[model samples]
Target: MRHDHHGRTHRLELDDQTLREWDCTVVASDPEDGLVLDRSAFYPGGGGQPPDQGVLIWGGVQTRIVGVRPRDDLWLVPDPDDPLPPAGTVVRGAVDDDRRSLLMRTHSGLHVLCGVMARDFGVPVTGGNMEPGVARLDFDLAEVPAGFKDDLTAALNTEVTADRAIQVRVLPRAEAYALGPIVKTATDLLPPDLEDIRLVDVVGLDLQADGGTHVASTKQIGRIEVAKVENKGRGFRRIRLRIAD
Candidate 1:
């Protein structure tokens, strides 16, 4: 399978994040295992980002896809009450635009935060998680500087206003590692057997190995608010962020 494939399904979202709706054929369907499509734009969750939610329409019938399971094939879990499309059925799949778009902004915003923290504070990210418009990233900071939250919030929005272009690329493992410290996270969590690395670059700001969707530029992230800062443990500072119009 290709880098853009999950089993038999060709993952369209990996190459085109803006794709919301696409026509595909049903390769397999099971009441419990869910539906598998020959081509899909639904993003199967990974790298701390959740899977996409959407619907499959065929023959005037609709199957609400509530979640995606990355099994041997990309399984789209449908609403239990909705009728399942049988195998060989041709359907139009649509990802929830509001949810996916917001998530893209939120994910890009986090990368900005990571870049700022690394450049200004000299700390690496410890962990993180995100939803549509809200997220939290943990940092390996031994001490919180005075006025850290306010300073960080101001710096983040400044970068967003800078309107830096966000670029994504796939590089061979050795070539990517040669760039040095591409994993801005505290730990090297990438699988050893992985032969290729997907990288997200915030133009002149940050470049790191990532596998989540993102907006085209920083300005698309809108405004960023530092909602809260917490100390989970020694050297663990968690910063929560909220994205607003």
Candidate 2:
């Protein structure tokens, strides 16, 4: 029985607070950084955006975030060099505000790109990464026109200017599966519990089973432009974008 704070709640204010429900409490430390928080608003870095970084403080000890990787069902934070306190130790967990914010906005922008592409030209995502300033996504299409890049750039900018909302929710896996099958390229990341699923919806644009943290609105993403589109292979094309004002 696990869940994330999304559809059930509104007005995610941890945004203004520099913390996403960080509190001091006793938790049994697991080898895997998959923190079993009584509750966590911090998404475990999936669908891009990378893992989160934060400090876990206990008594006089401070354990910096080494790697916040998600392993299927659990998000693991491993202390390879220094061993964390014994299980059941009360500690404070803090998320890296700057990193988290950037990741959030970048991730949302990726969705916006997908939505617009799907709506206008029928492009679906093959892969993507929500890096700090630049994001990249692989699209499956052939024979891009010379003006294709400019056209897409302008269209995506229009989307960010519109500032649509981005939504994240955990739904029953069976229910999510009922929505549709995972794109072949994304099948590997599919949740084990077809009955329990995570859904990331770009309000009126795009929606899919995702477990990633994103901004509340596209406005938070500012503006975007296609930096470059590389020819990966026969039918795969890579698009690099820059987030701007």
Candidate 2 lDDT: 0.66
lDDT of each: 0.94, 0.66
Once model 2 is optimally superposed onto the true structure by TM-score, how far is the C-alpha of residue 30 displaced, in angstroms?
Answer: 7.1
Off by over 4 Å in 2: 4-21, 24-26, 30-42, 69-83, 173-192
Can you give the lDDT of residue 166 in candidate 2? 73
lDDT for residue 62 in candidate 1, whole number 0-100: 93
Pairs of colliding residues, candidate 1? none
- Residue 206's lDDT in candidate 1: 93
